[model samples]
Target: MILVSYFARYREQLNLGGEKLPLDASLNTVDDIRQRLIARGGVWADIFSESNLMCAVNQDLCRLDQAVEDFDEIAFFPPVTGG
Candidate 1:
């Protein structure tokens, strides 16, 4: 299984902090996982559609093309900003 987490506005909007999903052919890459979330529609689609959103894998910063595997921890969050 893969652990998916959301942070900041993403967590608030989705009303979910984390969830587990089976690792399968349909979710081989970070982008695939993202697309799946987007497919949920409504708030999910809006949050993930943000081009500046950030994604991480196993606590390390990663790209959308990054490979995903079983037992991996993936995190999605909005871009940080400073005033």
Candidate 2:
């Protein structure tokens, strides 16, 4: 399982703070997981529509194609806007 979280505007838009997903699916990378979420339609599509979407794997910066492991803490949020 993977712990997925959303913050800032994304949390409000998705109406969720976080969730857990099974690793049974062939989603080994962040990008793969994103595509699956986009397929869910509604707010998910919007959350993932941007190429600059910020992501963290266990709270560390990570990329879309980055590999993930079970129980990994994955967080998604828009890029920080403050200076």
Model 2 misplaced stretches (Cα beyond 4 Å): none
Error of 2 at 58 (Å): 0.3
lDDT digits (tens) for residues 31-72 of candidate 2: 888888999997898779788899999989988989999999
Across 26-80, the per-residue lDDT of candidate 1 in tens digits comes to: 9999999999999999988899889997999999999999999999999999999
The candidate that achieves the highest TM-score relative to the unseen native structure: 1
**Candidate 1 wrong stretches, greater than 4 Å:** none
Local error of candidate 1 at residue 37 (angstroms): 0.4
Which window of ten consecutive residues has the lowest lDDT sum in model 2?
A: 23-32
